[model samples]
Target chain A: MFEGYTLAELGSIFAMQGFAGLILFSVFVLMALGLAIIFGQMGVINMAHGEFMILGAYITYFTSNFFLNYLPALFSVYFFVAMILAFVGAGALGMLVEWGMIRHLYRRPLDTLLATWGLSLMLQQFYRSVFGAREVGVELPQWLIGSLPVTDVIEVPINGLFVMALTLLITVAVAVLMYRSRWGKQVRAVMQNRVMAGAVGIDTEKVDRYTFGIGCGIAGVAGSAFTMVGSTGPTSGQLYIVDTFLVVVFGGAQSLLGTIASAFVISQAQSTMEFFLSGSMAKVLTLLAVVGILMLRPQGLFVLKVRR
Target chain B: MRSGNIFLKRNEVVFVVILSALLLVVFPMALDSFRLNLVGKYLTYAFVALGLVLCWGNAGILSLGQGIFFGLGGYGMAMFLKLEASSPEHTAIQSTPGIPDFMDWNQITELPAFWLPFHSLTLTIVAILVVPAVFAWIIGVAMFKRRVGGVYFAIITQAIAAILTILIVGQQGYTGGINGITDLRTLKGWDIRTDFAKEVLYFVNVALLLGCLLLAQFVRRSKYGRILVAIRDKEDRVRFSGYDVSNFKIFIFCFASVLAAIGGAMFTLQVGFMSPSFVGIVPSIEMVIYCAVGGRLSLFGAVYGTLFVNYAKTIFSESFPELWLFAMGALFIGVVMAFPNGLAGLWQAYAQPWFDRIGQRGAPRPISPAPISPTAAPAERRT
Candidate 1:
């Protein structure tokens, strides 16, 4: 496939595709990060994770509209406000769903998947009703609007860079929150031994709710970041759900670092393949590889060295 | 489960008789050919749902990729119908005269090697069965042999469905692309589009479904079915008892795949086309939900679940399109959370006892076991 390209063209191709891959990597990382928490840690499959992300997208969409209409002066910084609002909105909804739906099905993880799927359908219909069925995009602030010319043929979009940077910061924050913070410790403790954690003075129920909330909150942020790259639609989130689940599961579901690593590998492979083959073919191949690898290594790329 | 007199205990025989009558006579007599054809279309899904009862409800193996087999069988049948429809006289305008129109539209002058075997009707039918069985066998062996049960197996199967859909849609020239093998006109000179033909086809679909129901009932009643329930509830216990657990899982999964394949093939015949839309994660999971709604444990319930849910879907999407998802989503959550046993469970708990009371005066009713969470020690196993 590369045989037709000149040396300079090949360099530019790899560089450009690699950059594109990096943006994809960021999206996968963010989506898989939230999924790893709820699904991997809690043992609850939230099939509606994608819809929760779309909720964040809608929140971002509405925030942009509010800032545009009512606070034009602050519109340049609206994304920051929108990100926070997306977090709160998505997190609150997450907590409510966890309380109303997920909590009952904790003993049945597969049932949680089905129920959340139902929630996802309702959310999608709600989005369709509220936002209209068409995909919508947010107006980028001036600072995030353009691209940086790296070379004559290799240019990187500034919004792509911004999303990647945001992903990095959030990834670090999540790592710190998961590994370094007290709440993270409590969440981990509960995940390891729910009864023991409760016995040790952890509010396991509250932890479960918060953990689910925060995980969904991150998906909101992912959706917010997504508005920069692609238009948001009622069905947009669903397109990524299977891929994101694959990323989390193939990463060895319980490990955050594994999620990151799996996302990077998949995104890079997919993007590079996109340049060589058609986009759908690339997706098929990448997913086939992931499924194939999973068959061989069902625990995935990483394991926590723990017994169930 | 009782170890003797396994064809059907008294109640099951009554259930089968009632179901067969409804499927064979009641539905046909109640509606026009068009509605009957639609019911036939829905019955195809019942095939998938019935298989789900054994695999997911009975054996605790939840496959989210039943669509793959369904689509494979549909596509295989569609391919043969397509070739027959795309005769040299019919497709004379295309660059390629003898091939299906989609291939010609994509500028392929010759048939793909893989699609050649499908030109034969006998081969296509065999492919419809064998292909999915082989595919399911491989997948079931890989995942179950590795002890990858639960959500992991579900996700992997879903990924396979996604991959297959992408492949089907991407390679449009070969697999008819996303629009699918459309404009299927006949089945080897038999005009399938006519109302009389449709009525005949409806009976064929019902016959196959009843046959499948009987087979599923036999399995459910057998000692093998007992082992499946045992595996579902206490997999480790069954493993320690020296039965090859993976083999059982693989066999059952293959059986489910074959059933789904038949459904898919029937679906194509009834609906006139098959597309990648039915071969994705969404449709696959929706099929599971159909079984879940029907009473995942009840084969009789599986048919009604497919009929009523699809009937609702057809009606709702026609009237209030937006509310359909809400209804569907609620069904999923409600089924899993509130009524895991579905309509069958409801029938057993409330309706059956009431009917029995009406049937006999002052007779002591058989006490039905209350519903228990699948995780809890089984207060009532279905037998």
Candidate 2:
């Protein structure tokens, strides 16, 4: 169809595709980070992680509504406040679940999968009951609702840029938290050797709670950010959970770098395929590729050095 | 001692005979049409649960993707039924010709190449079993051989289910998309709407369930079952003991896939429809929960678990629809935390005292504790 396209046109098409990929990669990273922490670090098969993100998206929706009605002048700043609130909201719920249910079943990872899965279904239904089943459009703030012109022939959406930046910022912050902070060290210690960490006076329970909260909080952030690009509904989280898990598993459970790399690879593949084919086919192809790759390297792209 | 042995033998023989009689004769008369249909569905789920017992419960491998196999079998059957319904003779009588409604809507002129073989019942049945087995065998060999275990294995399996669902849903022209293959017509000229057909399907499902359960029982008592259990408990230890752990896992996984396929086939037969929703990650997770709640260690537990939980779902959905999910969540949490042994475990525990009391002096006691197998830890943990 494009056989007669000039080199310049082809170059522009490639550039646009890369830009689209970068936006998708950011979303993928945001989605996977929370899951990696929950499943990879804590060994809790948190089927409710996606629901936590939806909670954030709903919080963002409410914040936008409040801003439009009561504080129209501060609409642009609503996202920041909403993001913080979402983090707290989802984090609090995560802590409650941890203390109430997940904490009791740590030894039984498989059981935890079912428990969390049931929790997810309940949450989804609860959202449906409260918000109605239809998708809710969160009005984008005026300042963030346009495109940024990269060239005469090519343009990128400002929201995509925001997501990319936010993803990078979050990734860097998470890296710092994991590597530089004492709490991060404790989390790693607990993950590596829980009994040894406890012997050294690390509060493994507290670590578990905090780690879970952080993971859920990130999910909330991802959800809130997703309001810019996707539909917000009762079951919206279901759409991303599989993709998020794919990234986490394909990346290698314990490696953040692997998550980032896999996100880039998967998103790029998905975006490029999407440009050529339809959306659903692209997803299928990407999944098939992931399954094919995982078949080759069952441990994933990056293997953790921790002894089982 | 002789009397005791005789009593034990009598109890085992009588138990089977009574159960068979109940299944063959009593159940049909005791239950109403709706209840019979519900039981039939449960029996189908029991088949899936039995497969899970082999893969997750017995093999120590938590396969979160049995739904894929189940869905493949389901879609396979649905495809055949759809083809049968769309035969040239039936199409001439109907308003639309050749293609199904969705295909007509989507402007598909010809049947997809892959779906052509489904017109033959023999080919369809073969495909139903072979497709899932082939898929599982390939995936299982890749994963088990590569030494993937624990959460990693679970996640990958789940990914497979998710990906498969998406693929099926995306191919709107061929696979009926997200709406799934629904509103199926008569199966092999049997009127699906008639009570007689439903009854026939119920009996067929019961037979399949009993046959599969017996086969599972045999497998469980076999040496391969012993090795599978060993691999589950300690793969490294088993490997050092000169056993091929991966091969055992693959074998059980393939077996489980076939069982899931049979369940799927029966499910499609009873329901007379199939959809992508039936084969996704959520349903796959539900399969695991079924085994967990029923008592993953016991074959009877798998059957019991499917019946009890699905019955609970029906009751809750009808009575307190809004709170159904909440109730399910609470039940799952409660079961995992308190009654980890599940309903089967509870039955065994409660039955033991009664069995002991009924036993006379010098009479052999039934319900002897079987030797603990390695893969039986999950079941034992529940107890």
Candidate 3:
């Protein structure tokens, strides 16, 4: 189909597709990081992880509305504040869930899956009742609303760039918190061996709560960022959950680095295929590829060296 | 003396058979059609729960894609019903010719080739069992052979169900998208709208439920059931002892899929419609909860769990629809925390003591501790 295209045209198309893949990768990483921590660290399958992201998106929506309606002059800078508020809102809900429901079901991982799933459905319906089932369009600041021109033929979406920057910052912050901070050390200890960590006087319960909160908070950030690229509806989270899980599982659930790499691979594959085929066909092909790969390497692309 | 013991066993079966007959024969007469239909739906759920008990409780595979199987069976029946309803011979005088209304809206000139076989009842029934079995077999071979178990397996199965639902919804022409297959009428020459047909369907569902329960019981008491439980508790040990663990997993997984398919078929028959909503990630998870809350280790748990959850769903939706999910969430949390064995576990824990004291003469044999913790044991097994 593109046999007659010039070299420069092909290069531009490739660059644009690459850029789209990077944007998608960032989103996937942001969403899956939280899930990986909850699932890999605590061994609790929080099926409501997507719902938590939706909670964040909803927070961003309301925050933007507040800025627009009550403080019109500050609208230009509302994105930063909205993102923070989203983090807190989603983080707080995560904490509440941990305290109220998840903490009790730690021993029964499978049961937690069902409980969180029910929680997701309930939250989705609640959002529908409160916000209406129609997709809500969040008003982005003028600075983040459009594309940035890279060349005569190639323009990169500012929102995509913004998401990439945000993902980078969050990734660095999480890396520092996990490796350099006391709480991170404690979380690692708990994840590695809870009994030993508890014996060593680490308050494992507190670490669990904070770890879960941070994971949820990151998911919220992802959701806030998603508003730029996708519609926000009561059930919008469902669209991302499968891909998010795919990224986490295929990347190897134990390592953040694996998540990033897997996200890059899957998103690039998907974006490239999407360029050549219909959207649904691209998704099916990507899923089939992931399933095929996972069948070969059940522990995913990376396996942490830990005793089973 | 062995013959006497056998007679006592047969007596227990006889009692159960008599009780089921009484319930099936009398319950519909006593209740309104709506309630009767509700009970019939519960029976269908019970069958699905039985499949869970086998796959999850016994085989130690936490399948989250049974909803897909259930959906396949449902759509299969729905296809036949839609065909039968839309046939020129049975079409209402006011109804449009050929295409169903949804198809007309979607501008479908002809039915898809895959849907052609659903015009026959026998084909539909065969497809219900075969479709899910084939799907499960392929997935099982890929996953179980690769040694994916525990959380990874659960997530993958869930992803399959989620993706399947999305695919179904996206295919607006054949699957009716999100709105699903609705406005279903007569079933195989029977007027579904009439109370007589509803009563007959109810009886059919009841018979199917009883038959399924018996089948599950038989499976559980067989040597194969013991091997399944052993596989759940210790896969490597069984493999080392010369058993092909993968084959066992595949067998049980296929069996569960068939059972789920049957349940799905019956459920659609009673409900008179099918939709993408009926089989999705959420419903799949709900099926697991039904098994969990009933106590996966117990046969009665499956039956009771489905009944209890479905009943709660009906009551809560009517009374406080908004709070229903929250309530269910709370219930799940509470059950996992306080009642690990589920409502059935609670019943057995408290009520079994009394029953044991009244019926047994000697002291109960000491229960041997299994090699792994019951809850954790299932996940440890590879195959």
Best by lDDT: 1
DockQ of 1: 0.68
Q: Model 2: runs farther than 4 Å from truth?
A: A1-7, A306-308, B1-22, B93-105, B360-383
On TM-score, the candidate that comes out on top is: 1
Better of 1 and 3 by TM-score: 1
User: Candidate 3 - CAPRI tier?
Assistant: acceptable
- For model 3, state the Cα shift of residue B192 in Å: 3.9
Q: How large is the i-RMS for each model, in angstroms?
A: 2.9, 2.6, 3.3
User: lDDT of each prediction vs. the true structure?
Assistant: 0.90, 0.83, 0.80
Lowest-sum lDDT 10-residue window in model 2 chain B: B374-383
TM-score pick, better of 1 and 2: 1
Per-candidate interface DockQ score: 0.68, 0.57, 0.40
User: How good is chain A of candidate 2, measured by TM-score?
Assistant: 0.96
lDDT of 2 by residue, B280-335 (tens): 88888888788878877767778778888898889988898988878877777777
Per-residue C-alpha lDDT of model 3 across residues A1-308, encoded as one tens digit per residue: 56877999988988898899888888898898888888777887887888888888888888889999999999998878988988898899999989988887777677677778767877888898889889987888888877889899999999889889998998888888888999888998999999999999999999999889988998898889888777789888877887888898898888878888899899999887787766776777788788778888888898888885
**Model 1 misplaced regions, further than 4 Å:** B1-5, B359-383
* Higher-DockQ candidate of 1 and 2: 1
Q: What is the lDDT of residue B239 in candidate 1?
A: 97
TM-score of chain B of 3: 0.88
